[model samples]
Target: MKIAIIGAGAMGSLFGGRLALAGEEVWLLDVWEEHVRAINDKGLAIAAADRDIVARPKATTRLEDIGTAELVIVFVKSTATAKAAETALSLLGPDTAVLTLQNGYGNAEAIAAAVGAGRVIAGTTAQGATLLGPGRIMHGGSGETHIGELGGGLTARLEKIAACLTRAGIQTVADDNVASLIWGKLIVNVGINALTGITGLKNGELAEHDETRQVLALAVEEAVRVADAAGVKLPYGDPVEKVLAVAVATAQNRSSMLQDLSGGRMTEIEAINGALVREGERYGVATPVNRVLTLLIKALEKLPRENRP
Candidate 1:
């Protein structure tokens, strides 16, 4: 299949490289001119725990260069989803599947508004990667990726995409309950991303420190309450424990929000924790902890680069 990764950041680069290595026609599209140039010049380098290899995938900054793709994976930050969807018109064919494996909520809706709801696929991935430099990435870990239709139910397109990803070495499942899958991932992000972004702590460090762990628990529990109020049943039980287990499992990896802060780029606080706060208000649920985390991250975004921690 011909694939286009809309945002060739760490996770995007990792997926594009793997698919290219698997002999798929993959094009990485991003605004990072240097990174795109590096890939086109030398190839995309991926360092896994077992070995390192350079995968040859086409890279470009201009969407028109990609023409029409069989599948367009949306990995752009949530802040840029609307604009990205609007600009992605050049890459969409009639049968194109637009998958959003992004960090937070409302991404599917934004894409649906542009390309119609039937063409949008909603899902989440647990795969972890870190951008070492231009055209280079470290594969921190691998986990399941789930995709499904927006309205729910297993469809041929969902299975076809899952099979393609699985063949590309990304373990993917075509699940019917994508809504729960998204909220499940959102709860995990609520417990980890903001705290790490604020304290500059690694994933496991959040669980190691008593104060941070307590705060993580409170934020996750509040999010769970809000989810319940909205009638969204999360796939997992004991959200707090599940979140801590995830933190410990991916102990050494930096949360994406922390990565944004370190790079002096804007973080996706509004989509993650801020989404919880807004949902809480709409549902009449109190999310004080999430509200505070959202406010702190938003404040940090406005600080001058030298002034940020």
Candidate 2:
């Protein structure tokens, strides 16, 4: 498969490296010139539990440099989804499948707007990676990846894509209810990311303290209410419990929002918690906790680099 990964950040680098090592033709495209140059010069380096695996995948900062691809995996920041989709037009062929495993909501719709609904696949992944440096990433943990068509059916193409991902060690499943899966992950992120970003706590640390745990629970409960009002059924039976379990499981891992703030970069808060607030307003559901979390994160985003927690 000719694969093109847009936004070759931590997640992008991880996927491209693994797939390229699996003998797939992978090309990583990103706006980071130094990262692209490093990948092109020295290959992508992925540090796993066992060893450091380096895979030579084509990479470029220039969108025009990429040829048409069969599969394009979008891993850009949620705030950049529309722009990423617009820029990704250069890599799309008629039959190309565009998959978004990004954080937050409306990514599929943004891509569908650019490439048509027939070519869009919405999904979520638990496989975590952390960027160590240019073209270098650490595999933070391994988890399931669920993908499905936006129209809600398990098609042959979906199965093939899942198989491709599984074969490359991504552990993917073709789900009929991908919206639920996406919401499930989003709910977890809603609880964890903002708390971590504000307090500088790791995933597991959120559960250890009653103070942080209360904030986490309230945020998730409000999000669950909004999701219920919107008629999006989450996959988890008890989303709060599931989120806490995930925090323990990925205890040492830092949330991506924390990583963004720590690096003095912008975050996906507008898309994650902010999206929840927007949906809550549309559905006439009160989301005070989520609204407050969103505001607090935005406040944190305003802090000077030296003053940030």
Candidate 3:
């Protein structure tokens, strides 16, 4: 299939470059001029646990340069989703499937606003990547990706796309209830991302501190209540336990939110903790811990790069 990877950051590069190496027609679209130039000029430099790959995938900053594709995977920041979606509209055909494999919640809804619900697919990935430089990404951890139709139509198509991803060494699951998967991902984000980000600590550090553990439980409890009100299921039997388990699994890894803070790139706070806070107000779930966490992260967001912790 002709594929377009919108937002050609580290994760996008992983998907696009690997797909291209697997002999798929892949185009990477992004606004980062240097990243686009690096790929188009020198190819994308990719290194994973299993192997190192250099893929000469097509890349461009021009939205017009991205033509029609059977699938478009969007990895843009939640804050920039609307603008990215507006630009990516050019690459969508009547049968094109647009998927958001971003870190936070509410991305699918935003994409649906631009491309219609039937064409928008929401996805979640646990794979981690660190961009060492323009056109270079270090695959830090292996993880699964789940994709599904938002308006509940393209099960077969998403399954086929999952096959392609798996063939390229990115394990994928096509689920009918993708919202549940997204909510599960949100639970992990709410538990560690902002707290670790604001504290300048890694995931394992949270468990070592009693204060952090208490706050984590509080925030996750509030998030669970908030998610329940929205009719979203927490994937694990116990939300707090599940989130802590994930923290243990990726103990040494810095969250994408932390990585964004380190790189001075914007965080996906609005779609994460902010989403919980908004839904809390809508559902009267009283998400005070989540609210405080969101406020703290927003404060860090306002600080100058030198002042940011």
TM-score of 2: 0.96
Listed per model in order, the count of residue pairs whose N, CA or C atoms clash below 3 Å is: 0, 0, 0
TM-scores of all predicted structures: 0.97, 0.96, 0.92
lDDT of 3: 0.83
Query: How would you encode candidate 3's per-residue C-alpha lDDT over 5-24 as one tens digit per residue?
Result: 88888788888988998889
Best by the lDDT measure: 1
Cα lDDT for residue 223, model 3? 87
| Ranking of models by lDDT | 1, 2, 3
Q: Write the per-residue lDDT of candidate 2 for residues 1-309, one digit (tens) a residue.
A: 999999898999999999999999998988788998999999888888778889999998877877899999999998889998987788888889999999998889999999888899999888778899998998877778899899898999999999999999999999998779778888989999999999999888999999998888899999999989989998879888988888877676788999999988889998899998999999999988888889988988898877776
Give per-residue CA lDDT, model 1, range 109-142, as digits (tens).
Answer: 9999998898899998878788999999988777
* Candidate 2: residue 67 Cα off by (Å): 0.6
CA RMSD of all predictions = 1.2, 1.3, 2.0
Q: Which runs in model 1 stand beyond 4 Å of their true positions?
A: none
